[model samples]
Target: MNLIGKKIKIRNFDENDLGQFLELVQDKNNHKLAGLEYTNDIEFGRDLLDMYRRRDGSYTVALQDNNKMIGIIELNKRGESTELLLTREIGFVIDKKFRNQGYAKEAVQLMLEYGFNDLQLTEVWASTEKDNLAPQKLLERLEFKYIYEADQTLPYTGQHNLVKYYLLKK
Candidate 1:
């Protein structure tokens, strides 16, 4: 099933989306924004798709009228090693050509609804590099409160860096 939006829908990814997915993964800026190591291999794309599928929530944001994949969004469970106090962290990356458009905002709104209401979550979290202000502003627009800045290995990316955190409570 697809989460409907005015001009987009969020749905599970399929093999046919590989081309557009590759395009996104190949774009230097987008790839970096997603905190991924640069790579052009199809195998890495396959691995990424598998990883996305295994997350708590993962969906492709596509055009409602044409089903063209425009971006990807996910909510993955994060917590301490004790298996308690698990939290859900949101992440997204838009196709380079689609940046600055409203698609990412709409898609994130859809995902937040799912995370908060459907998933019965109390809060959703997000983080980005200190230099990534676009995402910071986007989160602020969505009413996410700025948390604190910290230096740590971005869990998903395995990279150590300064990062800013944000949180929104339902």
Candidate 2:
């Protein structure tokens, strides 16, 4: 699936995307709220490539006007459900240089559409650090309701305190 909006396009991740993907993931500023640190390991990239090949979810790259990868969006099922009703979790990370441009919001909107329509999900949910205003505002703009607060710690950076959001498809 492909999702285009404004000056960005979301497409499936390719092996060719390895270089840019690695750079993005290694960016500390871009992953501040996510509590991720810089890394230069090829194994991390390979693991991500493997995840991209799974049918249960997707790893999409957000391309800019110059066709450079500026972000990534993922939609994954939280559990196995034989019935049509199911729930999914959504996540996104945008490059620091491309932030404040609404690309993450657009990418997430497209993911929600795919989750509700294509994947036939009953609800989609996401969580962010309580202090992360960008994602909180983005989720609100997408009509996701503030669900509850949880004390969570990032295993990577050890950041704690989080707020969760939920969006139910009508």
**TM-score attained by model 1:** 0.87
Best-matching candidate per lDDT:
1
99 Cα displacement, candidate 2 (Å)? 0.7
* RMSD, one per candidate, in order: 3.1, 3.1
Residue-level lDDT tens digits of model 2 in 96-134? 877897788778877788778876778887877678888
Which residue pairs in model 1 clash with each other? none
CA lDDT, every prediction? 0.84, 0.72
Pairs of residues at least 3 apart in sequence or in different chains that clash in candidate 2: none
Largest TM-score belongs to which candidate?
A: 1
